[model samples]
Target: MKQGQHKQTDPDPAAHVSAGSLQGYKGLTPALLTKLAKLGISNMQGLLLHMPLRYVDETRITAVRDLRSGEQAQVQGEVVHVEVQYRPRKVLICRLNDQSGQLVLRFLHFYPSQLASLKEGKQIRALGEVRSGFFGWEMVHPQYRVVGDETEVATALTPVYPTTAGLSQAVIRKWIAWALSHADLSDTLPASVSQSLNLPSFAQSLACLHHPAPEADLASLESREHPAWQRLAFEELLAQQLSMRRHYARRKHQGAPALKPSKTLITALLKSLPFALTQAQQKVALEIGRDLEKPYPMQRLLQGDVGSGKTIVAAMAAMQAIEQGWQAAIMAPTEILAEQHYQKMQGWLAPLGIQVAWLAGSQGKKQRREMLAAIADGQAQLVIGTHALFQEQVVFQRLALAIVDEQHRFGVQQRLSLRQKGGQPHQLMMSATPIPRTLSMSYFADLDVSVIDELPPGRTPIVTRLISDARRDEVLERVQDACMQGRQAYWVCPLIEESEALQLQTVTDTYETLQQSFPHLKVGLVHGRMKPAEKQTVMAAFSAGETQLLVATTVIEVGVDVPNASLMVIEHAERMGLSQLHQLRGRVGRGAAKSSCILLYQDGKLSEMARARLKTIYESTDGFVIAQADLAQRGPGEFMGIRQSGVPMLKIADLERDHELLEAARELAERWLETEPVLVDKHLARWLGHAEELVKV
Candidate 1:
């Protein structure tokens, strides 16, 4: 057979056997199979994929006398004595002696069968952390296996697997070995591709990883950089890239309304703007314009830093839809953001005789009825709302474009539902949280990305300061001084209500305190728990400058743009995510005046992770750098909110460490898709368990 090609032979009967069949295997019981199911090992393939987290080096057994104080070692000796002591927490002590010296095996908890197995004069192989004990050098809870007189002592690394309470490493390894022996171990990748990449066959990689030779580099295996690990990671990344490329290709075949370039409304709106569009904004707007003009539906991600004027670019795209005699809709994650978009859209388009409608879940029956009717009749040229716009009852006359703001907050299904509402309308997703390059390439392979890398000129740079909470009084006094200077400020709390468990400051308590401190000044509050109308009212007051200070939760993190607000003080800033803190800081520095952000962390010792987060924020103002740091700290899943961002779950690939493999896989996938589209399904099936579900995103 070839290097990657599978042999053409009859399928092995064991290929069809499920993991539950393992109950018939030599040690596993029915109850144990049920326990294994909880770990997602339901079939033979699942068991194979449950790779070891790490390995124990038992290649060379060490003598008992040669053991160090704090080193993990493996030793083989004859059991000299075994006893169960009642005192000192019901201890079970077994002493083993070799030619060099004697070692004690202390088991704080053990079964009667374990005592029987460790009988006197039984030769046992023990592996564990060696530590100094009261008696002598000992190993607590060491993994020991009895050896018979004729049994061979192999010099091979031991695989340590992730297990639940009822399962043991020995049992898991035994079952895995049984499954591997019976498995057909077919080659998944084609010979040509594998040879070009110099990657091992799927079966070969699995075998090497499961049973690494003693000569294998231990450091490479531990760091997951061995050839076997690299092969698996590359295959996983290639599968994802293939799925995304298929999705991208499939969308190209779907028909959409080809919107023409806006000549009248867009020209007038641009002219009417108080300031000129930045070069970056103009470039992105043109990219979006070209995408809108295509017959195929446009799936593009518009990424810009906070206060980078992404909203205007979206407005320009919406205008293209309206000018072509079709309605446009913009969806935000929250009501405050939706209302903010609504107000901005109305201000820009209402003057051009465009009808803008607002539809949120909190709208009254009569108001919603009017808005729905206008949308259906095509009278509302542009509509701005939250997820409520995608409701079944809310029908659009002809939605030519659907722009989703902060797209990560919405799930793939929710966004797809909106697209299905209007015969595959052109979609534009916007994110103010600038995604790192590696993440954008992997997570958003299906969409064409346009980045607004430059901020619009004339915006003031915000000065970031990390202050301990012990200086709360000093910070509060500074806030008062800023308010007295006729400037606005935002005092953000992490929680809306005081949690006795967390002991963090609450928005309500902070509002009251600020209110009392500045009795003459107006204070506004907004949070997720507030009614939509009430929240809108408070936000309106804040924007109108009716309130000099807004004490609220992170609900004001995005979409509440007040250029005059020059001060941002986040209490318990350590509790907030890095991206969120950047967004909150972005609220200021929007105006010409100099701005300052005070990160008030709790006094005393903070975790190393928290301190790192604060230090990263303080050292950099670049969103891309901060995003990379956040990805490093929180990982791809949490940083992008995996489910919401529609990032496919990678089983083996690490986006941070395996970036080179990802790049190679992307190139190979693209080349394969271009040259041989017919084999794509086979490639996907071999690696991707749910390619169909991932493509829908």
Candidate 2:
């Protein structure tokens, strides 16, 4: 995105020139508008923000004689010959000469207007990739225009934009050029603020980006290290921060019923637990307790490493609400994970006279009805399920607290729907995939965060070993040994397309393979495609030690807890992301016996990225360290774990690369929201456009 030079004569440095709407532009057709809408652009602000993916040096022309095969070049010459041929295929051909040499212009697809435009003796300028054809050194379908010798070339590099199916670079370029010339290219940040942050003026930045001088550093531009790029990145980051803070404030003002803890159920549950709460768990639970006691709504993200006692902290938070006679609901992303939570909640609370219900899509009609009735009547004090808990039929009687596990797996609307299930319920979002520090500060700025940095005292440390698939038989023997030693093992298949059927097939095939190798060992197979009852049966068997080995997909990545299961084998480890591999590795190392995770990667076929990821996971058992490496390896977008459908994502700024910019934006956003509300409005309006409301939501 770019703007032109601003005159000091303007009364306000933050003066905004509205470009109005792209609909008012006579050059763009209705059909083109529809296509642009698919790309999330519908007006001038969006057009101004449409950045170039790359640029071409079309400012000069190469001599016809100097043309080389496979080089993209622009050449000018007189059209001396022309003809249409129909031998193997109908084609139009033209020959041009510019004194030193001759060049052939080939067009396989042509119209009569093109033929008439390429008449002999007309000087033509053509640009495209040069390649060898039947005629030596030819350019097929080269863009050309009949010209006079006096015609001058472009002063700036031609911009190529990211476009959709029916859009053209030339058309987008034309619109952007018009926007640069006409749109209000004024600064949104105050001059004092930009100067303090060492950022460039908005107008200057836009001008440099849209029409860089011919001698500009293209590498700097392409890599987005140029000063102009930083300026735009800062603006976008600022808008997001402001939007988040405003949303946070808006929610704070919409007060909720404070779920003050009577400590009756909590004290009972704590006394009955087999283990005491870790210090970190107690600290975080206290933080959550303080937030829930406030009259305002609590939107907190509870982050902890895999198997770091987050489940108990969530249970502790739920008891606070339940003690006040209000219902509490916990939603997990998958049925397997949800069922585990249900079983645990049932085990912990059922004895304390607390009713817990399970809601899932695969439940039988009669069972689902009973669960629904219990939830609606407030008889079920603690409810846990997959996304089904947020469905229309399941209404909470007095829902005061909502806990979501693996929160990133849910969509924006799904999360929002769950929030709306109660009248401003306090929300607790739990994640095992740790958020990188900078990401938590910037993208997740709105939510209060509590981190359980300490693991429980008695958990065993996991040893990660990388082994090639070439030694598959050796790895199989290791699994057999572990299972035979009175310990359980997990053989996890790679997630194939994230489709339930495909994942089921993957685990089934793996199950069959292991069945032949270990016919004596009882192995259980579970996947997302199985009915809830069926999955529960298999998981129950594994938990009860009836099954010695379990072969499953990533469904076991989060909530399947068997302290006796100490060995984890992840197939195609090279194909998985670092955080995913880390989570999978965490499935083991829960018991006192020394645990080991074998990363079974294909031999001699690992890509550089995959190799780096495997190495990162193998080197560190610390979730935060692995998380930072994962962020660097995959970039913040993928590392965020939330899908694009959840929120408005960054367009220019990268959470890893531009963290300094983000930090500056974060500090400035908080200060300006109170001291300079006008500037914040202009900046958010320009950068956020139609996304202002979406980001707030």
Please report the candidate that would top TM-score against the real structure: 1
- Give lDDT tens digits, candidate 1, residues 1-697: 0011222223244444543334455344567779889887765666787888898887788998889988999888999999999974799999998879889999998887787788899888888999998888899998888776675655668888888986767667767877788765776678886787788888888888888888888788878888788888988898888888878988889999999898898899999999999999999999999999999999999999999999999999999999989988999999999999999989998889999999999999999999999999999989899999879998998988999999989888889888887988999999999999888888888889999989888998899999999988899888988888988999999987668998997888888888898898988888899999899899999898899999888899988899889999999999888999999999999999889999999867688899999999999999999999999998888887775656567777898999988899899888888886666776565565443347544
Please give the range of 10 consecutive residues that has the lowest summed lDDT in model 2: 1-10
**Model 2 segments more than 4 A misplaced:** 1-21, 64-72, 81-95, 103-120, 128-143, 495-505, 695-697
Query: Weakest 10 consecutive residues, lDDT, candidate 1?
Result: 1-10
Tell me the lDDT of model 2 at 363: 85
Model 1: colliding residue pairs: none
Number of the top-ranking candidate, with lDDT as the measure: 1
Name the lDDT value of residue 107 in candidate 1.
92
- lDDT of model 2, residue 377: 95
Q: How displaced is residue 256 in candidate 2, in Å?
A: 0.8
Candidate 2 lDDT tens digits, 316-413: 99999999999999999888889889889999999999999999998889999999999999999999999998789899999999998988887778
